[model samples]
Target: MAKLKSLMSCAANRLQQASGLDQTEARIEIRALMQHSLGGVNHAWLIAHGDDTVTDALRVRFESLLARRIQGEPVAHILGRREFYGRDFAVTPDTLIPRPDTEILVETALDRIPPDQACEILDMGTGTGAIGITLALERPHAQVTILDYSEAALAIARENARQLSAHNVAALHSDWFSAVQGQRFDLIVSNPPYVEADDPHLQQGDLRFEPITALASGTDGLDDIRRIVAHAPMHLKPSGWLIIEHGYNQGEAVRSIFSGHYFANVHTVQDLAGHDRVTLGQLT
Candidate 1:
């Protein structure tokens, strides 16, 4: 009978040795696995239960999860949930895992749309409905619609909205602006595929398990961004905002695309890491 603390230590050591993850990340991953197996308990619970004996069945389950982590499967995918914008969003292989950087896009959108305003918001390429659902929940008066190209992705987004009880959110299946023809919105936001087709990072770590269509854009990784910037103006009302989350190094190119399209107030904002992550423009 292994103790909980010993099991966690051994698992963290195995992950650090086999997955090339540093000690801190390995520990974090081990803690996440423990939390998953222990009924979503927090780290404090783990600390309090460190002396508890691990049953054979539970140990086997934890080991299985550890094996998946060693295989480069994302902890979010393994646990089936990811916390974003102070909420836990359901996740699956069908959709991109909701990332912390995307919260910036949500925050920016919330800042733009006032709480009392009853407006329409569109979240293009919404995977897991994190952005649109967050907006809807944050501003209950706003009518939020999230569109995805993949039906599987749309299903996950819809289920997330249902689970979160976000009544203001609606999920639709569309490739970009195709399905929303003639429907103008007060705000349009997306965290589209912005990674280069051949980017080396795609072959590494968690990206290996994520859907390629949700990550890679084009040769320079600006294909989807360009398409969105070109088409969003038509779907956005005059003075409406279009906010997009892109690769860290894509600020200049994205801003240029916005400028070429004659968008007003075009600008790029950095994430918590000081890397440019989101770019926005207004259709004037």
Candidate 2:
């Protein structure tokens, strides 16, 4: 039987060989699996108990998870939750795993709308409800409505809203603005499907397990964005802001769409990697 540290080292080496991840990243993945499967044992605990023998059951679970990771499954998917904006959100195959880039949208939305004011917010294609729920929790006075075309996705979002105790949020089934007809919002945000249908990257890595509808838009990956942009003005109050997460390469196209629609203050915000990740504009 391998000791805890030996098992971790072996797992990390295998992960490095399988995924081309550096030693540091591989160790991080190993630590995450250990923490998740070993009664929430953290990195520090693993280090402290380096000489401890690995339990058969725990080792089996870790090996299973490592095999899934070797096959390109995302750790968030394997763990069944993702952390976003200082909170953990339940995620499943029905929804896109909330990414750190999307946090910029939440931050931007919060910055635009004052926390003390009563605000009506719409999260298009809300997925796991990360953006909408986080906004509701951050600004308790805000009423957030999250829409998703998929009932399965909406269910996950609703559950996340419940788990997170976001009382100000409501999840609904809507194809864009269809279900919310005639309702206007102070702000609208989305992390929609912007990956091109034929993007080769979709066939690789974590994208394989994620729902295609939640990841791909069209040949240009702008179809859903176009739909949202066209309908957003109708659902947004005058002077209301609309912010969206898009593919890094889609920034110029997104900015053009907003500008062409006569939206003022149109601009893109870069993520931590300095890649354009979010675009925002205000209704005239």
- Writing each residue's lDDT as its tens digit, candidate 1 over 208-268 gives 8899999998999999999999988889988999999998898999999999886999999
Model 1 worst lDDT run, 10 consecutive residues: 32-41
lDDT of 1: 0.93
Candidate No. with top TM-score: 1
Expressed as tens digits, the lDDT of each residue in 147-262 for candidate 2 is 99999989999999999899999888998899999999999999989999999999987888999999999999999999999889999999999999999899999999999886
The residue ranges of model 2 lying beyond 4 angstroms of the native Cα positions read none
Q: Could you report the Cα RMSD, in angstroms, for every candidate shown?
A: 1.1, 1.2
State in Å the error of residue 262, model 1.
2.2
Q: Against the hidden reference, what TM-scores do the models get?
A: 0.97, 0.96
Q: Evaluate all candidate structures by whole-model CA lDDT and list the values in order.
A: 0.93, 0.92
Best by lDDT: 1
Clash pairs (backbone) in predicted model 1: none
Each candidate's number of clashing pairs is 0, 0
